[model samples]
Target: MVGYSALMERAEEATYAGFERLKRDLIEPSLSRHEGRLIKTTGDGALAEFASPLAAVRCAVEIQDGLISGRHGFKMRIGINLGDVIVGTDGELFGDGINIAVRLEGLADQGGILISEKVLNEVEGKLDVGFEDRGEQQLKNIARPVRAYAVRSGADSPLTERIGVAPALPDKLSIAVLPFQNMSGDPEQEYFADGMVEEITTALSRFKWLFVIARNSSFTFKGKAIDIKDVGRRLGVRYVLEGSVRKASGKVRIAGQLIDAVTDAHVWADTFERDLSDIFLLQDEITTAVVGAILPKMLRAQIVTATRRRPENLTAYDLQLRAMYQYSLATRKGLAEAIRLANRALELDPRFGFVAALASLFHMVKVILGFATDPQFDRKEAIRFLRWASSVDDGDPQTLATTAMVSAFMVGDYESSIEMIDRAVALNPNSHWVWLDRGWVYHTAGVPEEAIRSFELAMRMSPLDPMLDRLCVGMGMALIELSRFDEAIAAGKKALRHNPSFSATYWCLASAFAHLGRGAEAREAAARLLELDPAFTISAWIARGGQSNAQLAIEGLRKAGLPE
Candidate 1:
């Protein structure tokens, strides 16, 4: 009966049929099971009579839960009241309870259940569900005001349910950084405050272990005071960060506070004051401080949660966490264990696209690190797993970016790879993975400048990213292609400091040093590369495929005494 007027007038014929089918197949069965009898049916809703108020409320809950959780194509608002009523001989019920229920239903949100005080008093402590007291409301034609209570069904309540998708809270720590208020009383500094939040959000997202909502979604609440619990529920996040920035008399001050939104408990608060000598550097310093402060807190929180989870009840996400931890070890034994964990995760839930993509990336890593017994076979498996991941959820930027880069590197399908990665970037412009992966794709597609830009963007987005070595290596490769030998060598040296075992970084150093005519350094780097992968050769590089700009790298490698 709620919003039924527009439903009847605006809905198509099939919509009406679907509604009818919902009532026939779902509502009627639920009512029958609850021992409620349908007295009459209206175009949009129905009237029913139960033997007791408890039965009536339970039946209402069942019907509403069914319609809301099931694929009924529509949702309904339900109301129940417990009161004496007149039963006509024809079986139609006539009473103030019926009228009040109808009126309460109209007041309820779609897919909600509202009951009067009498019904709540009767059902209290009997059912597993709780009620949200909505306070007393004056009803039309009713002698007295009725106290209304909305049923609170855990996990299935209207407040929690989204359309066709359940809320996916982060398996690890999740946080949202709301836009910083500009308290300077100057409108021009608004961008500074907004940039501060964006930087923090971007920095946090790079943790890989933390789930940070994108700036676009978090900024929606800008300039609005909100309840932390409401924010947690709305965003499916457990923590929230809010702050303000003020700039006056050439001094910049930024203050931020992180809160456990669930319990409304303050986790941390800090303020930084510095002369605005260089605005960008000041922002960078603030970003580093915030990221540094939050990471340890989030890690402690994660450790506490992990300690609490029973081993037997480990979820696929838990397996993923284990897998990523092993992957981060970046050794042969670690890679093997990572693969094992990923396989176990797949066994538990094969439909998880993120896990599938992760497994695919593991294989890709095997190919790159020379860990596979048969590189071609591993390449094929990587492609197959990436395809599987895409089939599950192509919209996920992580999946798309990883899959796309794997396609480019393993299959040499740079055009299709770039297309997929572009889509990922479009889906989430703030995702560092998209930028990083697209850098590789663009480099292989013969666009060194574009590749460089993408890599720089990745660095900006995640200054402390665990994958910063990869970004440095990628930028070095692109710089080498541009014949910037010294710059490439510097980048390669930086990359080596982070991940000395990475063969690509050594290869970059060798090539750049050779091109710069530094024979001793070039030979030393080439020797290190051969130590890591003695079978590495120019022939394999040619077989792997590259763009026109790749000739510079090939020539430099040849000069560095690499095998052809």
Candidate 2:
């Protein structure tokens, strides 16, 4: 009940009489009608429970409507939450569930009812009343912020007005970073929280593969309680990042979670605690950590989604995702499937430069693995696709990086490949793909030390990347070039652990072991390599032209008794 004390001061006797009459005539009857049990009552307000959230909300609306229509001198405020409650010995309700409802009632508008997100989720579509998002509330005695919604009873409601048709999602991965909640209990720290979001948004925008919602568009939901699916629809994004920031004593903590907006599934989450010494540096560190962590997760999620879709329903982007997944398998059959998918994607969207670059990479891989039946045909196709990709979208960092690899391995244009990869790094240095491609380009150009450094940096950037096998293989080949045979063998073993089926791992191990005079191990590795790729030969590998920069590896392969 609202204004109870004020009404009592105006007319204590009449107020007390009216309260009793109203409780008997309206509140208790409405509660019974809706299957609600009145647990207990404070002087002005009451606590109640219901078996169904829908019944509880309907009862709240009925009571509020009765108060308004019957001209009750005072109005009541209500809050509803749905969760397990601790039943006391004396039949009193207790728990965070009850506490949250109490806090929500206190925060509710004078005559309005507020409901927790859990309750709203249960009662939203079933109820006639519309809900106005009250945003995330820092409830008293609550450890985490609770998202609340205000129930509005009328035909013309914000829910009806705001929830229109959703826009279609973009072809590439899309994301929106909602403003972080300030749990610092100080208004001044709001700027720090906002700054953290801005830094993350800026860093994520660097990845050309991601379509990030503009700050202005994302900021529109800053202080409103958001439905992840609704926000995803409105923003046309796949992922949403939301979090809270807390500053206490001499340190600050930033907690973040990545959600698949469409499914409302949590993909990734982490908390970073840092000293309050340098605000800007802290923002940068947090941003780097967040962006690096979520990129691989988003990719994995996308791949899974693409894999589940029917072949007939695949779009150009879906084909690209499938192709990438195939490429990650690192096998001759996987390479062939990747090329087929890439070509299909090109037919769907001829101007998809990323797919064009991917096609070039597939062909280059075929040549490298000696899988190409016609070496010259594969070489020509690789060059053609690279040229088309560069002409179509030279600005895309991923496309540029992939084309750079083809330029070095297929065309033997070391200078141009180096320049292209340098440009790609300048464009998106945070991208592990760019760094990985840069490593391969440098290795093919015979800069073994620089290749190792680039590969190591890539490993640091995406420590959990599924494609770590490729990085280790590059590092192993570079180690062999430096005559660090033992280190090369170790790198090969690690690569094998990441992907035992990868034929290149055996090639790396065979070369390293043979160079170290470990003939038995070398022969064993050579046998595994032949089992994986029966057509593999020293002549075909050299004829591919990329091995000019890897002469030591070629010599070691011959020493291991591989077919010449």
Candidate 3:
């Protein structure tokens, strides 16, 4: 029934007569053969009911084959669902069952049959045809998402071959954003919808932590009814984003939703309506909002997935995730465990630049937190691992960012560290970690204002990040340098809330309190710092390099009566 309107527009008398003959000769007889009760008929299509789901599906396939083989000028799209139906006195069907099937037909491709999950389950092995899982779809007017399947005519279809094998997902978060449907009805508005998708894809690509499918790969499914699970398999992604764009009456509406392709779970969804005054500005605004909203959700999803994985089945990437979680705790025991996991990951993948850089950063943390059993050995190993990570993959933004922080703090090479961090940010501007590294590098290079700006940008990008304490501590350091002692104290306390064992937060709090002439509070802060790091001393901290840029903090430590 797909092209009925077109046929009517061009039909002659002979064409109309032939169509009548087709219905009388082929369609009616097939319904009778399958024991289908014809309920009603419209100009373009008919509604029929059968006692068996299997009979209904077989009848659909037979009619489709007959239409194609008999050289009929048009094709039909069919949808089947199995559910309770309410029949009216006029023999009309009224209920969700009928509504869902109708919506599925609208979503179906020309000449194809779509079936609900219930129908699929009942007729799967009994039918000769194959079923392709279309994943969970939000049918028009449906209260909940429904899983649908596309029916293939033969056993030799590609879907049958792919039943047991699909591409493995990448270690990091991955997504594919399909081209949005143009709901404006005006064909000319296609370009606007496509541009919106492209803008979103490009913006998401800037996040170093995410693996985004290329635009060309994603656009292949445009204008076709697709299964989200199939698209995820073909693209090797974990999530899929799809939506619609409508432009009318001097305004535009865009609706998008993210789905976990593996589980068909709705991860996030939102809608934006705006005046179409500035199209490019509108695109930018939507892209930023979409990226900012989905990132934290995706990260949380990834963490949950990784946590559920068995320890023995851990991949190099899974080990890296575990290491990251441990590092977020910011305690001596946590750093030790994180280092161990990073080393295990390195053993599995010798050239893993991210984990190698993490190992180097963990060693540097030991010296900074006064947790190193042998400071000299830890410093040497930190530099050695940093060199190895750069040699393996200097272009990786995370590696470069971590290397820059180590260079600034441990080696006191401010100029080179700043250059490296700037390049990392330029490479992946959306990466919060890169911005966080920029904050620390600028702070140690004697630019407190720029450091504050960088830290603030990082916080804005990933507000729910587990490592948010790092950002808070960086901001506190910059505030102290600017003589904003009260703000520094507040920032330090916030950092403590995030990770109370972090020695840097105590250092910041103790210095800020002393600068504000709160002698008792400063002494209490210093006592807590001593408890965390029994070996901490004014002389030891100054000797760790980068102390020249922290003269104010060092003076405050002296005023607080810490051992020199």
Best by lDDT: 2
lDDT of 2 by residue, 30-72 (tens): 5644446678988887898775897688667767656655646
Candidate 2 wrong stretches, greater than 4 Å: 1-165, 247-252, 273-281
Local distance difference test values of all predictions, in order = 0.77, 0.86, 0.83
TM-score of each: 0.61, 0.68, 0.66
By TM-score, the candidates rank as 2, 3, 1
Taking the tens digit of each residue's C-alpha lDDT, what string does model 1 give over 1-564? 456667767876866888887775566555644446678998888888776787687667656655555666677888888877887866678989789988898778777888999888888876667789899989999989999999876563432232213234656678889889999999998989988986786656544335665554566688888898888777778889999899999999989898988789887787889999998988877886777666555555554565467878777778777777677667777878888878888898786677888888888887777677787877787888898888655656767888888888777788899899998877556666678899988987878999999998777656666657788988998999999989999899989988898777887999999999999999999999999887788887565444344878888999999998
Residue pairs with clashing backbones, model 2:
135-225
Best by TM-score: 2
Q: How accurate is candidate 1 locally (lDDT)?
A: 0.77
Candidate 2 — worst ten consecutive residues by lDDT sum? 156-165
User: Which lDDT tens digits does candidate 3 get at residues 1-564?
Assistant: 876767777875656676776675456655644546677887778888876798688668767766665656767899999999998977678899999988888888787889999999898776545778899989988999999999985543332223223556767889989999999999999999999997887767655456776565577799898988888887779999999999999999999999998888899998989999999989977786677667777877887787789999898878888887778777788889999999999999887787889999999988888778888998988898899888665766778999999999888899999999999988767677888999999999999999999998888777777777889988998999999999999999999888887888888999999999999999999999898888889999977666679888988998888889
146 Cα displacement, candidate 3 (Å): 54
> Please, what's the RMSD in Å of model 1?
14.1
